[model samples]
Target: MAFIGASRGAAQGRSASALAARLGFRIGLVGLFSGTLLLAALLLFSLQPMFTKRVLPILGGTPAVWSVAMVVFQALLLAGYAYAHALTRWLQPRAALATHVLVLLAGVVFLPVGMAKGFGAPPAEGEALWLIGLFLASIGLPFFALSASAPLLQAWFARSGDARSADPYFLYRASNIGSFAALLAYPLLIEPLLGLDAQARLWSLGYAAMTCAVVACGLRLRNAAPVAAPVEAELTVEASPRRRLAWIGLSAVPSALLVAATAHISTDVAAIPLIWVVPLALYLVSFILAFRPAQPGPDRTGRLLSGLQIAGTGCAFAVVVFKQTPFLLDLGLTLGLLFVNALMAHRAVYALRPPAARLTEFYLCTSFGGMCGGIFAALVAPHLFSGVYEYPLLLAAALLCRPGVTAGGLPAVLREARRSAVPLIGAFLAALLALVARGPQLGIEVLMVCLVLTLAADWRSPARASLVGIAIGVACLALQAAVMAEGGNHRSFFGVHRVYTSPDGQFRLLVHGTTIHGAMRLRDDEGRASTGRPVPATYFAPGGPLSDVFEISRRVNGAIPAVSVVGLGAGSLACHARVGEAWTFYEIDPVVIRLAQDANTFHFLSECAPDARVVQGDARLTLSGRTEQARVLVVDAFSSDAIPIHLLTREALAIDFAHLDAQGLLAFHISNRDFSLSHVLARLAAERDLTLLQRLDPPRQPSVGFAHSPSEVVLMSRDPAVVREAKAMGWRAVTPDLSRRPWSDDYANALEAMRDRWRELLTSAR
Candidate 1:
């Protein structure tokens, strides 16, 4: 009896040991997959800003460059998802693993990623296509390989025999969290700490580590049952076409809005990576919230959607009232609208998510939708619409994505249209009356009434709400367009350029985004053309700091022989050109040149600089082959108030200095609302052992002849005497802040550079 009892105890101990070992293995598998996904997403997101920063100098540092880059990424993501779907559908587990590993190894050849050489200079036209080709050739393989990892790994986990393998959508949350972390860390941590080369090296190491983790994940699941040989009972419904279309529609709205919002906010604020990341970070956060294991109930989702819709409509109203809102408030409103609207749409997407068997297919459809949205925003919209009409259109589309909106199909849609027709038609007539009467204030009041009525009418019916919301949006945009109808709108790869007469009707102003680029005094107080040669107005007023740079240069050098200007803003600087002096202007945007050359718009270029040469293309690319040395070089290039950091970097300065005579003066127009660029210029001068002087001229009250706006100019020279003489006039010798690093082609931190200005703003607000 004692021997039998002992045998029973040993058997029970063995069984317990086996159970513990199995539990440990399962936990290890989960960790490996999760960690691999996290690392892969980090590398994927961080690569965007890193690689784009490197290319900004190649092209001019325009925000449009970032838009095109997003399109490439979305396209690559779709391709990666399709590849994953194919592998899972046709290949066995071991074969699929081998294939993916080989693809990753192929990607390794492009490690330590940077732009590919031999692409040469980009074209004057078709820049979008050229840029797309460049990205594909340079970073395509590595990015493609990395993009496949998320879906492939999730699919792998589905077949891994783990307890939660039957529902692998939870892993998606981990992927986006990594994405969010990477985006936040980039501007805040990585950009401030590491140069581009260092970032590339560290990223390559992370990629290699992630690859090993992916391989380990494959090994962990090698002996498990094949995907086709499913054992446990689970959801197996084949995704119908209608369901696939629903997924696509739900995904497209946020993706398009992501691009549109980025463009809108960045155009007004600075077009730095930090601004670009905010919208994208919110977008990823929406995905994280949407794909969570638990979601809100139907009633809760409906309330959330309604709240967001109302808030978004209110924001639209604010945009109409203040054509150019305060930068910070505008940014907050834009991002808030994006987050709420995206969350609502993505929640609907998660509701229609397919089961584990169709995971890759589901991802493929979603990615394809994203690619479509990006394509529309980046490639098509600029050519199709004269203004940023896509933004409002997408906003309206987002409202339509609310739940139960299309429950009654075509018949339901007809009923909603009938119900909404009276209000919509009434709003249209009211808008027409406002336009015909030419009453701006009355137009605004009518818009307010229409919006309120629309929101209050059938607020519960998504169809009625969506239709009226679109009408309201269209009316608002149309009203704004009419208000600016006196101006001619021109769209280019760069941005919108509007030429309009000022409210006082004394100056013809050229505006980009919210900032006035140049203003020409067209008529005196008597409403007649001025007699003498047209003088540069606005920032280029006769007594301004920019004029002082030329005066001091002429004083030191005896006579200014040649002059080169980087930005051709109304060609105002051309009037400053003296006879017998060779003057050249380098302009990137063809549209700006056209407008400046049109004598009807502003005659600074045609009337004053007709004899001057104008070079087309980015100054960085166009100035490299210049033969003549200039005694004075002015760098006044700007896309709105945002200065191109590439043009201010050490490498860029070297190029400018190379084209300048030894005694030549280099003047940078540093007038900006958000940044104190004197700090940047001071550091650059110190690093290069050059002398620097800055002058900040305060604004004068508007006069009838020429309005003198505030201007700031920083002058740099190899000759100390030149800058010293300028200092005697009105310029102050600036000291470099040793605590801050100088910007270079390899490194820059626009956010950190703006820290002082931000502090000043906060103090003033307080």
Candidate 2:
């Protein structure tokens, strides 16, 4: 009996050992797949900001650069998804693994990513296409490999015979979490801590590690069992065309909104990674939440969707109508609207997601949708609309994605509408008030009422919801028309440029976004439009620092024979030219050049310096190769309130100094509402041991005629005579802070500049 008991115990011990080994192997497989996906996603997202920053200086640092970059990213993502789907569907498991591993090995050759060497400078026209080509040549293969990993690995995991392999869709949540972390880390840690070269090398190391993980996953797949018969049967049930179309629609709206939101905030504020990342980070977060297994129930989902839609509509109305809003509030409202809409749309997509058997095909369709949306926003919209009308138009379209929009069809919509008559009547009354009031504040109030009525009318009826969307769209269109009617709106690859006369009739302004680029004096003391000689008003007004800088140059070096101006804003500074002085203007935007040179618009360029030379393309590229020297080089370029960061770097200063004579002066117009750049210049000057002269010139007088803006000008020169003369004329010698690092082509911190500006403002207020 004792011998029999020992035999039973040994059998039990063998059974337990087998069970423990199986559990350990399963855990190891899960970790391999999950870790591979996480690392690939991290590399994919971090590459965007790093590469875009490298290309930023080639073009001027316009917000459109980031927009175009997003299109390229989406297009490649679609291609990668298609590759994964085709490989999995047509090839056997071993063949597919071999193909992918080969692709990964090829991608390694393009490591330590940067732009291709042969593309010297972006063309003046078709810059979007040029940028796409640049990206394709530089990081195309590596990015393609990274983008494929999420979908391909999930498919592999499904065939691994693990308990969870039947539902590999959960892996998507892991992918997006990595994406979210990457975007957050870029602006907060990577950008602040490392230069572009260092970032590229580190990313390459991570890529190598991810490649090893992928190989391990393939080895595991070799020994795993085939997909279960039930799963294969599920795969044979193909997704219908209508269902695929639904997936496309659900994916496109949020993708388009992501780019639009990025442009909206970055255009007026600053075109830096910090601002660009916010919308993208929120986009990933939406995906994470949408794909989670624990979702709100039917009733709770309805309430959440309704509340977010209402709030988003109101915020959109306020932002589209009103041009000037407080910075923080404007940014907050835009980002909030983005998150609300994206989450709603993504939830709808998640609801319609297919089983894991069709995972790669589902991802392919969604990626195609994303690419289409990006194309519309980045390539089509710039030429299609005079303003950013796509923004409001997309907002209206997103209402179509709301739950139950097609539930009852037209008849049910009619019934719901009849039931909602009271709210509809109230909304109509509010609309009439908005039309009559024509005030921005009252218009927003009316918008909120209409949106509430629209949402509450029939949450499930497309017809009813669309009616409300159209009404709000028309109202927004009319408001935009009113604003544009006052100006000549010109759309360009750079941004929207508006030329108009001020309401006070004292100035003809050149505006971009919300900031006035240049203002030309329209009226003289006698209240008549000044016609004979163009007057340089605004930042370049008489007795201003710009004028003083020119005057001091003349006093020290006698006749100033040649000058070069980097930014051609209405060419107002051309009036500062004396007879026989050769002036050359470098302007990146053709629209601005056309307006400035049109004698009918402003006579500054046409009348003042008709013979001045005009060069097209980015100043960094166009200005760097010049061999001629100038007596004064005025770096006064700006896009709205934000200056191109490339123009403020140490390398840019070297380019400026190279083009200046030994006794010449370097003058920078550093007047900005969002950044404090004088300290940057001071640091650069100290680095080169050059004398720095800075002046904060307030308006000389407030009057009905031409008035000057408070200009902050910084001048750097090695000549003692120029320095002495500048000081005598109210320019102070600024002491540089050695602790603050100066900006360079490889590294810059726009976020720090913003912080310093706000700190200065708060201190002054105190």
Candidate 3:
């Protein structure tokens, strides 16, 4: 019975192989086509992380980068679509084949998977246009070829297909499956096991194989379609190019929305390693479900799921806006909303798809939409919307997509509904406003009661009335977000900079990414002291990492420490130096220095290291040109949520090491919400023959190093004896270079490494 069932299932499956053979399918051409498609997927997926990492300095690593990249990608996709479309005419099939092959080969003049030597250098803010041009020069061809795969191959397949019947739609889905698999596989397997060099080589080999395949496919097409007009298959729906573009926009928007959600929610908060892939995985899965032909179309599910999305969106925003929601619940709401939104939007796209004749055009359009969504959410949102309000904005967009989906908290057909004892909508609103305007347990408890009443009132239309209920339940969220945005929260290329204002108005705390960077009360903020005098608060507060620059120099160099801070966050560390101490600060954002030295925020120049020189550029590149030397250096250039992968590379560290006097100290502020970077330091130290110690020091005390948990500042040195000193002070020697090779400017990938460690991290949550 089991054998029979298996055989039966196999028989029912689409028999493309036998059908092709029967129809005299040019096996070589088909093979080449499939190979090329696979190659494109593999190359694109493998290089995504590497490429995304390279452009960070330009994009400035804000949530906006995701949006900008998305838009940029979508626009690229449209160009590719237009290119392929244009190529079908003027250029014969053989000519197209010859031209594309030559183009692919030409991209190699700038070979290997890594970025150029000086692509990410700062002060490019003024030269951003030129920077983009340079970046495009580097990435355009590879991206163009890879982007052209689906449509180009599909067109090739159609032109060489069976005389009586040719189906291209199914092949598009196959390509999609391949692309998605590669996307998941990158983080899940490839990135962890392979460095960027290896991955790039592997991709090149795949492209080579694809090139061979394209040769055979083109030969087959020339032989078969010789001066003959191809038959036009009957189409159920014929859409203009412009309509197709709309389809692309539709898909791109949702895709970008997904990216934004991932960036905002997990970028700085998820205490997991390289977990950015999860949301992207879901996004790809939507393609799997959406591209496949639905039985009655995905509309039924789309409509139902879309409603739930609205609810999820409303609740999520309400939680944030009202500021009364738990953090975990907030994340859960976001994830839920995202999952549902993808399903609904993707299924809607699947439903709108035409037959095989228009399939490539359809997919081209879908890809276009995905690009748009990505740009809006990833690039535009962070800059445009002061708060991380992407969820609400996406939800609002989704609601518009659904058309006539009511948000007034009243079901459209309210007259037919069963009557309750009373209407609490107005009462609910009144109570919420009163509670928000008031204070203490009395007000909060009363507000909670009102929240419950409003939820009950809207129970009839949970899907449509979610936003209203959210408004009531977490009405304080709006106030919190507004207050937080006005002054407390700031978004920049460096990530989410959140400064919380305490109810007492006596303290201000700076939270970057996921960790609390500084917590200084007015008393602490106002006065600074080391062995005496006022000091600015932050990581460089008199006794912190900055002070180590001076203290270590005295111990190692004897007189004073010439220190360099990669990121001069308010120049607070300058105050820690004693007289005759020389210090140079490398700051990427001039705006940060301007604000820090504003005198109103907190004066560090008058209070601390009075004559600090600020070098305005990327620390990595700037250090490359510096002739100065430091006894101690801190690579706290953990700019933005987007980790400057290059700075963490062996090349960057070696440069820092070069600038250091022998027997000097290199302190790396390994503060991150996701991934234990200690492993990374361990790897870097091993590669460069250095010793390392991980430390976490509480305020006004000697630093304590913990080997067990993640939050740490790594102290490394070429001198093993100095590391021994740190270990004697409770600093456990962290295991370095236990993973693979260290990442470098040329190429580096820790995705696969992070993936391997996933089970360990997820265990706690599980």
Question: Which candidate gets the maximum TM-score versus the true structure?
Answer: 1
Q: Residue 380 in candidate 1 has what lDDT?
A: 93
Per-candidate TM-scores read 0.96, 0.94, 0.78
Give RMSD (Å) of candidate 3 vs. truth. 7.6
**Per-residue lDDT of 91-128 in model 3, one digit per residue for the tens?**
77878988877877776665665566655454435433
Q: Choose the strongest candidate by lDDT.
A: 2
What is the Å distance of residue 703 in model 3 from its true position?
A: 17
RMSD of 2: 2.8
- The digit string of per-residue lDDT tens for model 1 on 17-76 reads 999988888788888888889999999999998898888776778888899999999999
Kindly report which residue stretches of model 2 are placed more than 4 angstroms away from their true locations once superposed.
295-302, 406-466, 524-527, 699-706
Q: Extract clashing residue pairs from model 2.
A: 404-460
Query: Which is the winner by TM-score between candidate 2 and candidate 3?
Result: 2
Error of 1 at 375 (Å): 0.7
Question: Could you arrange the candidates by TM-score from highest to lowest?
Answer: 1, 2, 3
lDDT-best of 2 and 3:
2
Q: Candidate 1, overall lDDT?
A: 0.83
Reference-based lDDT, residue 149, model 2: 93
Worst 10 residues of 2 by lDDT: 404-413
